[model samples]
Target: MMKEPTIENFLEFEKKYKCNSIKVEGMPIWSLYRYEIHNEIKKQTVGRTAEGSEPPINKKDLLTMALNALKPFNYRNVDVLFVCDGRRSKNADTGVYENIYLDEISKKFNSVILEQPENRKHSTPNGMDNVYFTDRVAFKTNLAVKLSTKFNTPKRKRYEAGVRAAFTDIFKAIKEEFGPDITDKMVDEMVDRMYYYEITKKYCGKILDKAQPKLIVELCYYLINNFAMSELGKERGIPTAEYAHGFAFPTHTPMQFNPEERISVLPDYHLTYSKSQEDEVHFPDNVKLVPVGFPFFERERDRYKAKYPREEKTIVFISALAEGEQISKMAAEVSEALGDEYRVIYKLHPKEFGYYKERFPWLANSKVEVIDNSENHMFRYLAESGTIVCTRTAALQEGIGFGCRVILLNFGDTALNLKTLIEKENIPLVDTAEEITDLIKNNKAAFVNPNGMYEPNAIENLTRFISEIMMN
Candidate 1:
């Protein structure tokens, strides 16, 4: 029998093939491409296609460049610089998209935010200065790269040709290892990503030259611009960090780095939600894990705890992008089986926001109250609910912190991803409505160590960590 393409098998293949050794322009290219390769592996494992949100193309590149030049903003000698993607949410009162990860942290210093544009209802609100958009940065970088290509020196020309040849050879080895799953087109995409990083690094290097920030931080460091910032910040002797955006599950590809791998680019520090998460990942020697806790979660938990009254019978189903269909059906079944006695809330993942109505038509007619807007705070729902249901969401940890017992869905990779919770907390995994209904009625909850998941004094810890790094 053929071996399944599980993470363990993939890791073995990666070690045997020495994928980390693959380089482009002195970069260990495997770190840049591993996420893409893992997505394919996951698709095959789950029998589902990967979900993606295509970045908007800057059509008016020249116009944007001109406007930026006309109203240039200064970024010289800043205390901290935060690079964030378009994952933002509207404040319940303000209705403006806020950077949930770094908004609080950014207030502690003379910080500058470089945010990507997203197709959202509102942009970052006024009053706070030093907020800059990155579409123009991307536009300027692309033009500079094109010009550099047009007028390359003799050595530069040779280097370009060599890089192309190197990718061709690397693709052959990748094809052999991954079988027909790896493709020539995918290899080409990776090559484009290679050039994108190098050019973005050069462009951001100029900004760093002016800013000379004491510390640099990003939400998710794997993205192209953020990864470039990490590499550049390290080269310039500036501290770089990535905030813990979600739980570092064992099967999570981006978090699963081999210690022996010669991965070139990484943030100097990983600011995690709690110290307990330190064991969840195997990071490179250069990277340090700091338990800074979660300021946003803490703030929300406290605010909503005061604002809302807990409904003991309310069940909130936290959805994951990949397992939306299955979760929706299960949540509906549980709601119907329980009838008017229970209040069920189904929260859709951000990726599923656009097409969920079409994708899950039953949700419209189901007894569950669907929370789809980014404005609706998840912690608010948690504050009001007594029990949480999920398959593979990081929110399960947060749910436990809110004093809610969990009912994990039995299907999919829930057992694999949440193995620790199942063992330690004794969370129940149920497939049928009868199991869910019985669990709710019995009300026999397991003890969960909330302090282990989220430490006390998050904002203080984060500020102190930043201060220490800056002083050092």
Candidate 2:
């Protein structure tokens, strides 16, 4: 009998041969890597000494092979109805985008409709299209979640193996294409992203059936779900586009440079933040990059005149993953350094505040008033803040928009791409707590956009871009 193929065996193979995948001429990085792994296993095990035996295939391989096998959905008719999902961020969803931008966009076209998995939805508007991938994905995910509570069973473990393998494929694929410039943390992150991305594709067939939208427009197209949604639209011959919600830094994923033109899954049109961001991603020829301003910036608060300048000293610290201690220590340091003149406000990411709280027990003892907003009101802190500090977060960009003197704590595994943004934006990147104090005391940073970082006509550009794609 052939040796049973396990994730352990595959991982051992990966660690040994992880850096050895050669690029195929026309294929994308992942397709070539998958091909190599599958063939290498077969070449070693299935021939020569043994008379007749086939190499054992793993679950992840099976899924990847099956990805392009299915014929796309064909809905013969068409409506100008635009379909998209709600913002995964609760704050962004309920805040302004849904009520303001989405409503305005919806009104411009024939109608805009929601596409959400039926079982997973809650309090979504009743009139929207209900997609049906929840039955399949929910069963697998719920079981994994339940089994994850204490320990996973052998059966659960096997499926978990598949999950890890999927993530591994994604990580290897990025490295194979982009070379060794990627950080280990980013590779790991993109893997989990690929796993979630695969689950989201399970919705495409359901979405296509319910609403054969002429064009699919999504918020935050960079996210796995929206990206997956747009890819599915392309598969079925529908035009797709995305509105830029934030900066697309850390450009290490396949989304930045899809290897094969045949399987390029990026959205057809990208409504970007500005010209600076447009030059950042370096996407392929087929993907249209449109420069637009940040629409939400018009609503950003510029009103507060300093009435009592001394008392208005508030330092806001945006938290980073596994850096709870750093945040707490920084808060304490800022308070001590400035005495009663400065107050530190730490804003926690969902990871820090959610299930991973145990990893950050120092939050309880910290002097800073930690906040996690449901209203996307991090802007309020930036508006009122005298100085803002972060590891690597979009809030840093928000701080820029508000004219707060920003500082980046570039310690440990803070993303290299963030360093790129800091250099480009001219924000101060500090290493030690002492450096932060000096920068804060000096109040030395540019208050104006040097690169014309924000284009003024965002909504106009986005609307016009969509109109062009639809017309084409």
Best by TM-score: 1
Q: What is the C-alpha lDDT of each candidate?
A: 0.75, 0.52
* Superposition-based RMSD of candidate 2 using all C-alpha atoms, in angstroms: 11.7
- TM-score versus the correct structure, for each prediction: 0.88, 0.64
What is the lDDT, from 0 to 100, of the residue 128 in candidate 2? 27
**Residue ranges of candidate 1 with Cα displaced over 4 Å:** 45-50, 55-71, 119-122, 138-179, 444-447
Model 2, runs deviating above 4 Å: 1-104, 113-202, 220-224, 250-255, 258-261, 302-312, 322-325, 355-357, 412-426, 445-451
**Clash count per candidate:** 1, 0
Model 2 lDDT per residue over 1-472, tens place: 3342222343334345433232222112342233233333333443211011223334543343344224243333344434444333333433432332354555566543443332233223322232212233333433334444346456345444543554455545434532322334443333333344455566555656666677777665544446566667776888777766666663323234432244334667776777767655655567777787765554433432232232236888887653566665766676567665567777776445443246555555656667754344566667667777886565666676666766778753344667566666677766667777777777764343423557776667667766776787
Query: How many backbone collisions does model 2 have?
Result: 0
